[model samples]
Structures are given as structure tokens and as C-alpha cells.
Target: MFDHIQIKVKDLKSSKRFYTAALAPLGFTVQYEGGGAVGFGPKGAPALWLGEGDSRGSVHIAFAAKDRAAVKAFHAAAVPAGGKDNGAPGLRPDYHANYYAAFVKDPDGNNVEAVCHKEQ
Candidate 1:
């Protein structure tokens, strides 16, 4: 439904390190980069973008997961690579019966999430 997203970070290199490790579990990689920004997504197209800035705002970005396990893996990989846990992997009954997801705050305090809407 959407084409891409851009986020501002305090430091490009540090944000790159955090995102590189965090998004790896979801099969996304850095697709392009310039002086003040880095982009990540599937090959040839950059979906999520990070830019250098001061006082990075709290942003919410969610990735679609193939299944619940992928969400778990995302959280697992993110935390060890400088991501702070916001939530764990589990069903979010408030959203739906099978809204399995995980949440983390990246180096720049943007709220990143991975969710799977499949029965488990």
C-alpha cells in the first residue's frame, strides 16, 4: 500500500549499525545511502529510510512478518544489536486473536515493530 518511509537519526553510522542488525532477521538490507541518510528494504527499492538529525522523534514503523516466529526472531536479533525491548513476542488480543508481534526502540528512539496476523 505504501512506497517508502524516512526517519531522522542523531547519527547515521550508529543508526546504520542498529538497523542493519535489527532488520536482518526480516530479510531487509541497506539498499542505498548518501551523506545524511541510509535506506533499507528489498533489493532495488528502499522502503525504510533513516536520516541524520538532532533529537530524533518517536516514530512507529511496522514490518509484515511471514509468521509469528519471524516476529520473535526480529526481537531477538534487534535487542543484542542496540535495540531496546518495548514488547515481547505474543498474541495481542486487543488488536485481534492472532496479532502476534514484537516491539523495540532503535538507537534513535524510533518505535520499530514486527507483526504477524496469522493463526498459531
Candidate 2:
């Protein structure tokens, strides 16, 4: 539904560090960087952009994971990468069967998640 998203962050460097590590398991990386901004997504296709500026509170951003293991890896990596644990990786039966996901708060406090909806 969206081509790309740009977020204003209080610290671009910290955000970059956090995202680079957190999104790795979900297959995202820095694809572009310039003009005080950085973009993260699959190779050659940057979707999420982060720019240095005053934070506008927080927002939820969920990335698709290939499987439950990726979701768990995301949580394990995110916490040490400067993200705060919002929710541990597990099945969210309320959402649906096989809704495995993990949540973390990014540098600017945005809720970040990696989810896999496939049954194991």
C-alpha cells in the first residue's frame, strides 16, 4: 500500500545502528545514504527511510519475516542493537493461527516488529 516511508529521528547514527542490526534477520539493510538520511530494505530497493530531525512521537512498523526463526533472531539481535524489547517472539493467537512475531522499540521509540504468518 505504500512505496516508502520516511521517519524523522532524533539521532540518525543511533537509528542506523539499531536498524541495521535489528532488520538483518528480516533481510533488510542500508541501501542508500545521503542528504542526512538512510534507507533500509532488500537489495536495491530501499523502503524505510530515516532522517535526522525532531522525533514526532512514535509509530508502528512491521516487517515480513520468512519464518518464526527470523522473528526470534530479530528480537535477539534488536535488543543488543539498542532496541528495547516491547514483546518477545511468540505466537499471537488473537491475530490468527501462526502469527509469530516479535516487537521492539527503535531509537526514536517507534514500535518495530518482524512477523511470520506461516505455520511451522
Candidate 3:
């Protein structure tokens, strides 16, 4: 339903590194980079855009993962890329019976998350 999202970060390079690793496990990659911003998504479409600036406020974004393992992988990748662990991978029954997810705070303090809802 959403066309794309743009997040403002204090440092462009650092945000790039954090996102590159964190999203890799979920099959997202940098699709374009120029004009002081970078766009990430599958093959050709860039759904997430990171721009250089001082963030007015922290943003929360959640990507869909194929399964639980992908959620775990995203957490592992995020930590080393300057992300702080917001939540470990687990099934949140409160959200629903099969709501598996993980959360991380990006370098710019954005709340990033990956979630899987398929039954397994």
C-alpha cells in the first residue's frame, strides 16, 4: 500500500552500513545511491530511502521476513552494523499466534524490525 519511505539520518555512511547488513538477510539490497541519499529494496525497486540530515524524530519501520530464521539473521546482522538490540527474535503471541519478530535501533535511532507471520 505504501510507495516508499525516506528516513533522515545524522550520518549517511553509517546508516548505509547498518542497513546494508541488517537487511541483507531479508533479501533487501541497495538499489540506488546518489544525491546524498541511498535507496534500498529488491532488484530494481527501492522502497526505503536513507537521506543525510538531522532526524526530527525516530521512525519505525518493519520489513516482512519469510520465516523465523530470517528474523534471527536480521538481528545478528544489525548488532555489528551499529544497531542496538531493541528486541530479540521471538514469537509475540500478543500480536497474534504466529507473530514472530525482532527489533533493532538503527544508528539514527530509528526503530527497525523484521516480522514473519506464516505458520510453521
CA lDDT scores, all candidates in order: 0.89, 0.95, 0.96
TM for candidate 2 is 0.97
lDDT of 2 by residue, 1-120 (tens): 889999999989999999999999889999999999999999999999999999878999999999999999999999999999999999999999889999999988999999999997
Q: Name model 1 segments beyond 4 Å from true.
A: none
lDDT of 2: 0.95
Give the TM-score comparing model 3 with the true structure, all chains together: 0.98
Candidate 2 minimal-lDDT segment of 10 residues: 54-63
Model 2 Cα shift for residue 98 (angstroms) = 1.1
TM, every model: 0.94, 0.97, 0.98
Backbone clashes in model 3, listed as residue pairs:
none
List CA RMSD, all candidates: 1.1, 0.7, 0.6
Q: Write the per-residue lDDT of candidate 1 for residues 1-120, one digit (tens) a residue.
A: 899978878878988988898888888999999878899999998999887887545888899988887899999999988899999988899998989999999987888999999997
Candidate 2 residue 78 Cα shift, in angstroms, is 0.5
> Compared with the true structure, what per-residue lDDT tens digits does model 3 show for residues 12-113?
999999999999999999999999999999999999999998789998999999999999999999999999999999999999999999999999889999
Could you say which candidate leads in lDDT? 3
Pairs of residues clashing in candidate 2:
none
Candidate 1 C-alpha error for residue 98, in Å:
0.8
Candidate 1 residue pairs in clash (backbone atoms < 3 Å): none
What alpha-carbon RMSD in Å does predicted model 1 have with respect to the real structure? 1.1
